[model samples]
Target: MQFHHHGYVSGDPRVRPAAGVGINRPAELPDEVDVLIIGTGPAGMLTAAQLSQFPNVTTRIVERRAGRLAIGQADGIQARSVETFQAFGFAERIIAEAYAITEMAFWKPDAADPSRIIRTARTQDDPAGISEFPHLIVNQARVLDYFAEYMANSPTRMSPDYGFEFRSLSVSDEGEYPVTVTLLQTSGPNEGQERVVHAKYVVGADGARSKVRESIGCTLAGDQANHAWGVMDALAVTDFPDIRTKCAIQSGTGGSILLIPREGGHLFRMYVDLGEVDPNDKGAVRNTTIEEIIGKANEILHPYTLDVRNIAWHSVYEVGHRLTDRFDDVLPDERGTRTPRVFIAGDACHTHSAKAGQGMNVSMQDGFNLAWKLGHVLEGRSPESLLSTYSAERQVVAKNLIDFDKEWSTLMAKKPEEFENPSELEDFYVSTAEFPAGFMTQYAPSMLVAAADHQELATGFTVGKRFKSAPVVRVGDTNPVHLGHHATADGRWRIYVFADTALPGATSSTEEFAEWLASSPQSPLAATPSGADPDAWFDVKVVYQQGHPSIDFGAVPGVFKPQVGPFKLADYEKVYATDPAADIFELRGLDRGGVLVVVRPDQYVANVLPLTATAELGAFFAPLLPERKAAAVLSAATEP
Candidate 1:
């Protein structure tokens, strides 16, 4: 038998405040397209690429910039972001050219010698076992380049039209494209010329001054951070040993500086503390240039020699933390009916200091979270209510991010005397150590994520949190594979049967597991109409402690892999058993078996229950999914 990858996409977004709504049908959508993405940054491009997985979904992306970005943007890719990248096949491309920042060294002025700075602490950049990849560095422009290449190769492809600016979006009564977009050409011969485009959905990936956000009536609320920072991405000459590594340098007199090693030609990125700059002063921000930033770097790293051989790009920015109150929105048509046709992501929805590198990664993750839900609704597989989760999840993440940036940016600007408070420093460092890895993000329970009450279930692999991956072996073959590889982010909800058939003192029988699966009324996914697409609806698979020698491959029951044809299996693509090479079960806190876990399309644990609790599973999905009129079908079949 040959194995092939099933085209898929996964979603992982952030936390948001709670609100309530039932799914309401739009009056109608026009004949234009399924999706339209505005602003071709990582957020917009990623949303376009993921939409390509659905063959029937039509997509278009537009950019206001004259061309691709040259420089000066977010560059850090955390562990969770790497996993998200791997889903789209761009992780290796980045890893090939980009620098993987594994170790972080912190420097402070020597206690007895105030003039010289010494290493205070050194540790791994990411927590162990968080992900397969670590924190990585590449310019934001290069990241956009990778997204462009992926979109070019997608099965359902769309290219971005540059120099196009979005003017406004209006809701329509009915047809294919319900949302009408007004666009203006911003550059070239067609500059100032206007045109109109129709789309069923419009995503705003424009920057902080997002017109889409304003047009839709969303407001950003937060205070400007007191510190001013200078960021420089350049190819430079330096004698610092840890310059090659990502480091935090704290000066006794001048201020603090952060080092980020880039991928191309020995480039390095620096964020230098420029002290307090007036928030109202636009000239203050514009006046600080590459030379000014370089001079500041010299002040911070006094003992270490520095020279800028060639600066690629630089910017002077104040830490102004602001976030929108909402993420998902329903724009009113001329008559004022609400439909969730307009949305926003990335810096458009939230803006803050570049210190944590969450801007690019979080924006892309938002795209990943939303694209598939739109794909399902456009294809008529899922209910419109699913769209509400986007605002619910991502807004929480944005709020948490703003709160964190407040403490961190303040500490970076404070004098050494303020660092004497060990508790405050420890709290800030604890967050610094955790949040950037992209693992700390967790969503609260709502309509989508129904689960057993278990928060400490194996340390972070709880209900409403991300489903971590593990290594297991195939039943017919001893080949080892990470279970996560099978749970591709391609937008399929999964029900995992952690089979304990071979475990000692196990009370649950294989027959019981098989029976529950075979009965439509008893299975959690029983509500899905019989004719529904398996690829789009739900996937069933099993994992076990070990395969019993007594039961031959042919003797394995039909529930594990069902049969519709002569001697063919039904559901099981591959049977996975524990692998001895790695103690993955222990690592993920899944050593105890005989449980059932329901995972959302975005790869988060939606529910966890006993293997026998199929009814609970059915109840969980009942509210969120469309129901099948099975009785009508059965009546027609009987009459025929």
Candidate 2:
């Protein structure tokens, strides 16, 4: 939201003045580029959005579709995705238009009648209150449109190249652009024509039947779960009281339905259990008709009746759980010496039942995680070793998602009598709510993610997991805000220094630490290119335990008020005071003495340390950040 640093912005601030590659950008695909991403799905669009932040890197994304996705199959927006939308500067807008899932009701056959259905239990969607963001239900296409708008207004002005279908790609160890790709024109005058492009790295977000995955010899290696479900987005009138509410209904003899209320109030999606499919009847379930699905739904409801008005969309899908061995082209034998040039993401890496509502949420995270690493490596901000961590971290997360979805999908497919306890479905849903809400993903220890040896320093800010936001008051404006909200997807590491019980500018631990960070050559701030913004490479902010009234804004350290933009205006938004009503220190379990947290560009807590541990702080960022010598080479290579 901060603007006008360069000069007065009389026009809309959201539309940034395009620069570099965005200035009168080429109309056709380049012969060579920094990164080439395939597909315009959830993962692909997010990848483009993140890479758009780096104007210096030439990134191109192509989709087989003639234009943008009109209607996407996925609609479930988990709480974690809403947090990501906030980072991209569109959460409020999307939430305003999205359906907020507040509670979920479970239904079973009536014990007295056995022929009718009755509500068994009802639970809050976010019972644990894991995130301040809500569980949303919005169209997948709308999410893509938001990202597209953000990209258009970004410095890079990125947009997907439509009608270009990916055919194949090959990797070489010898050239700057090691990955050579073949694309087929699916529309326009060049239809059926083929062309070639080369890239330093390539990402395949091309979905389950990804051509990029096939060219890389990666296989989706799991079997069908022998269950089929018919899903439809419909406008219907029904006596079922929970039609507007999310419901899990299991009939005594018919089947089950996982009903999800959609955004426009009157519309909702239903995943009608089409019963188990025989192993030999692979594609048979797809033939299940909409009328048949409605009949099954009516049977499940028993005494209730549904008058279908309109059908927005419908599909029949067999539940299958599959995952690739690795997300990149690097073989197991080539792990040490080789760097991955061709990579796959989203459905290319993992596939599971859509019933869990995880397909889009998880895929978007795949793009978010990989884009930062690719940006770092391409821009020479980090070594090639950083690229290896993407597959290692995300592959494990995908596996965990598959496991959870498998259990949830199986439970939904069961008959009411099959469960030892009639409330088994509701119990399981309540118990593992966090996982489905997208807060349970914890990346294991790696070069990027540090071990939890110092976790107690900020117990709430768990390492290897997403940084949870807490309320704090900005010192300069005295406005209450979330600390994590200040951290955006701008490809800069965050250094959040939680000050000890001391006033700003005082001769205390915070003062000494701030001075050293602003002056020390070993500090991560030194990595910022000369004449660039002081916080170009690292965003340094300080939060004090003291209330806003006790702090003098002018006395805050220079590190928290670094001069930015052409005017060299002091950025006063970095200094914050704990909210009196909800102190972040107590809420997040931060050590009263002081603690320094290192958060990656993706908003995951990377490391935690004592504020006075200057050497430890320097050591942590030393390897991740580029030295002046390496940055100079990057400058020369990137010069226009």
lDDT of 1 at 578: 72
For candidate 1, write residues 1-640 as lDDT tens digits.
1221222224211111111110121222223667878898888888887776666677778888888888747888877777777766677778888888877777777788756677777766654556777678877788788777666555554457788899998877787778889888898787898868888888999889888898788878888765788888878778777778777788887688988888864888999888876757765665777788898788778678688898777888778899987875653232124447889998999988888788888888788888888987887767777777787788898888878777677776677767666334434565467676776777788877764564333443578767787777766666677776566545678887776545422346544664555555535445455544323356666677664333345555444553322223244454667777665456666536466777877777888766666667677777666664443332222110
Models, CA RMSD each: 6.9, 3.1
Q: Which stretches of candidate 1 lie over 4 Å from their true place?
A: 1-31, 173-176, 187-191, 330-339, 422-427, 430-432, 454-460, 503-511, 518-536, 547-552, 559-573, 583-585, 591-593, 629-640
In candidate 2, what are the lDDT values of residues 487-508, reduced to their tens digit? 8889999999999988986788
Q: Rate the local accuracy (lDDT) of all candidates.
A: 0.70, 0.90
The candidate maximizing lDDT is 2
TM per prediction: 0.86, 0.98
